[model samples]
Target chain A: MKTAENAQLALLLEVAGTPKPGNVDRERDFPDLRFEHFLAGTVGAGPGLRAAEEGAPVGESFERAIAGMSQQEGGNTQFGALLLLVPLVKAASANENGDNGDAGGDAEDAPGRLSPEDVTRVVEATTTEDAADFFRAFDHADVYVDDPPEDAAELDVRRGSDAIPAVEERGVTLYDVLALGDDADDVAAEWTGGFERTFWAADRLAELAGSAPASATAAQVYLELLAREPDTLVAKQHGEKTAESVRVRAQEALEGGPEVVEAFAESLVADGVNPGTTADLTAAGLFVALTRGEVSV
Target chain B: MKTAENAQLALLLEVAGTPKPGNVDRERDFPDLRFEHFLAGTVGAGPGLRAAEEGAPVGESFERAIAGMSQQEGGNTQFGALLLLVPLVKAASANENGDNGDAGGDAEDAPGRLSPEDVTRVVEATTTEDAADFFRAFDHADVYVDDPPEDAAELDVRRGSDAIPAVEERGVTLYDVLALGDDADDVAAEWTGGFERTFWAADRLAELAGSAPASATAAQVYLELLAREPDTLVAKQHGEKTAESVRVRAQEALEGGPEVVEAFAESLVADGVNPGTTADLTAAGLFVALTRGEVSV
Candidate 1:
């Protein structure tokens, strides 16, 4: 029972990670919610819903596949696009101290408890760029382990990629992007074009960074590029790349300027990305990455 | 988000329908514990982990699948198995009114918040039998709906059966017990034989019963016959009559006293059925069906 109780908390903290002010203490109480069990049940029944939405399968095996996975661990955990963000969840709850919690132990074996102060520091240390870094690095690392090192730069990416085919199959798109089929190039080309014309040329220049900013902000570069090729495959790639770039640039810009982080985040809000969504944050990271030349499109 | 949150809580409360006293209100904080996202994750992952340990396709797909489900809407909620019993959990936090502040609202609403008083009531109201009934009924019910009814007797069995095929495929023994194949007859025979030996033949029953008072008190008489002859197959011609007889016997015994309930449950326990496992719980339910003449063992 002690294990069961603790297991509940462990899972919730794992998913919710850290808590921000105004948000629930995700890691603290979320496990007590039993959200996964509910998902298993709903999703287990969702095939019927899926059957109703899409026509029923000719045989039971299709439905069985979904159900077969249901009670299987993480059967109902698929969050489509949100899944990519899950790798950073542990980092959110992880105590930076890496202490083992024994007074008799050496400094290396100190307790790893995250105090409210630690929570504040970690939250402060975390940024959109960090999150993107998490995604990029997470794909290449063993994010799941008994004692995942705090600074393991390279993880078993092959192993991580091998675990979730959907990540590859979907190719970052929330839908069945991997199943683009024979017309993959055509569909990719068109979406790419739309991405360039709509989000890049228009949204970026007009709303994000203006054509002529005070300095060569990554956001400014993003705006300029979109202006050059409004409707092209390159634009779409640039758009996503630009967001990633902006995040990186912004973090660098904010170094030693503690006050600027909040402002930069708010600017992202003005640009229409939900701070909660990964794309917007990625864009913020792109800023820092572009400025530092750490990543280029 | 609200509905998702509520659904998460509902799932937890459902799973933790009944818990022992001190077990519900845990003292530890969330990150301080080790939570299993898949309550059945360990059990479900059992095969996968074993397979991995044995050098099988320790592929990321299986583990990824489990991890995905770990953050499922219901997974991150506060209501996991023993986790919900924690007094601080919002689901268990109630107002002056006895309402689990958030329970009856849609899954979109917060989970009917359970107050300490409400938690106490829920804990008191729930028995192992009640918990089993909840799962069986949940098995039959449509989990996608916003609010699952509180009354287990009112659940739709046919719809519940819809989930059966999928559960069968997953081999989730808890909800899939009724789905045994050719070997079911053999297993059923063994179960019945064990029941007869443990309950019907035991003359020192009173002594055993008195010794384990908690166990003895909740034992139901009809549950005894259920313990002995679950899954007894009767010919179609005699099936209805047999089922009716069992039902009559059950109703009459239920009318006798709580002691009958105690006796029934005690005998089953003495037979060594752990209610935590879905297979055992379902088997017990089968016992009830047979004893009540609902089905032939």
Candidate 2:
């Protein structure tokens, strides 16, 4: 529950931050998901996340978050972030037991730090039901996704929970579901790749936020990530070429600085270009930073 | 725990809403109380507030919130808000039990809504220990307040828990301590007067948020309250005349519409005027709106 809040608070910081170029901010509200929807979603998800801490499966908690967000018009405001947060929550709980020297079985001698392997074990242990709940969550939200690969046509997320039986028939795990789309989705990629980029962003946020404000440091990290690579969600919504061009514009904004970043934000909003994948990454980064003590509060 | 989150979320929303005329908003942060500090305080206070719902004294939860806020450099970011929220938390819990028809005693015929009497009963029931915790809370935070009146010299808030003996000797309860400042402090007034303005603002917020956004409605309610009367905190820090002048300007700003409100915000920020008491009330109002179902997740 604490880790989930850490992620949401991190998300709120991201939402309030300016000059990241093309996301809803304190000054601008998306037509569907205004800042309030994000607030509602974060708080609404609190109960289910807390339930997970007490032994509920991560998928059920996640579906609860989706239902919670569904209360607002903005259907899937934090789907990507929630995907990243769930395993982290499990890992943190394990770390808590490890710290108290009570994690006697598989957790024996686990380090104080919530490890990548801790998250991996948790994600790998997810059941077919978990996978179905996740698909249902997608159906409940207006999440944007690229066309499924031909070989993975059954992976149509819009099918919602109806895809559950097939998932069970194939004996596919939630990990397999993520592996299918890891190539096309950054969030899916994190799920399959042990969340490497999120950890990297967390380290960067902690080091930078120490000297400046969390909001400013969060923005800097978001821009750095966006400039380094094109956001996959942007590629999915707009074409790959446009995503690449957007990354180039971010690079130019970085080269020119804050004023340039502000102008770049203005242009992106005017052009209706939103790099949502990067924002999701920022939320995951914030979660990692908070749990890892790189970012306080 | 959910109620604590509700209170804290209301506080964060209050802190973030902009053009609020004089307090910190998304675009601005206080040097002492960073928005992060407020975030930390809210989350840190969670456990104790939850414990209160399970039967702990409201004072203990309030003190817990203070301890939580003190962990940050910006001590007491929401002390006044906490004062209002602690009682509300208790009221909400009682309301929950009443809803289940398990409230066997005084709540036997309680209505669907959380009443002013519910809050007053919860508050009036606080012990002398709560008063001591409150004093300790004051000592914990670098809160802004006027010089103590001569008759109440021994009531120096700086005395911390050390004042417990004096409080006990005088047989003064938590209600009495707030009553001491009731005439001079808006937070204290809320406690003594059944939170009349907060409920009023909550009604206004529900009405307004239905048409617009919760953030916009919260900001609007704040401006209305500021325009209606001089804030007691402002009157304390800058004296009655300056506070009165601030109120006159707020009234004029209301007459001039949102553009004038924007201009008023700019002037207030530039001139170092912060109507903190008004912001605290807004937090309370938001809590009422949220818990009352006038606002939703």
Which candidate leads the pack in TM-score? 2
Give per-residue CA lDDT, model 2, range A121-201, as digits (tens).
778788888888888887678888877778877877778887887787887778888888989899998888888788788
User: Please, what are the lDDT tens digits per residue for candidate 1 over residues B1-297?
Assistant: 121222223223223321111111111112211222323222222222222223222122123223323432223212112111111121222322234543454542333322223333333332323223323333321222222224322232234444444444443332123112113232222222322222231222232333422112113322333334432232122343553444444455456655664453344334332222122222222222222222210
Model 2 agreement with the true structure over B1-297: per-residue lDDT tens digits: 256667867887787677788787766676665666666666566665666666567788888777766655566678888889888877877776764233444552255466777788888888888887788777667788765668877776777777778888888789988888888999989999999988888888888877767777788889999988799988987888888989999999989998998899888878778898999999999988887778753
lDDT of 1 by residue, A1-297 (tens): 111112222223222322111111212222222333333333233222223213222112122222422432322332211121121122122332242122354442234421223222322333333323323433422222222123322222224334234343323321122112112121222222222221232233234332322112333333333223221222233354644555554545345243454454445434433212222222322322222223221
Q: Clashing residue pairs in candidate 2, if any? A: none
TM-score of each: 0.22, 0.90
User: Which window of 10 residues has the lowest lDDT sum in candidate 2 chain B?
Assistant: B100-109
**Which whole-number lDDT from 0 to 100 does residue A117 have in model 1?**
32
Q: Report lDDT (CA) for all predictions.
A: 0.27, 0.77
Global local distance difference test of model 2: 0.77
How well does candidate 1 match the true structure in TM-score terms? 0.22
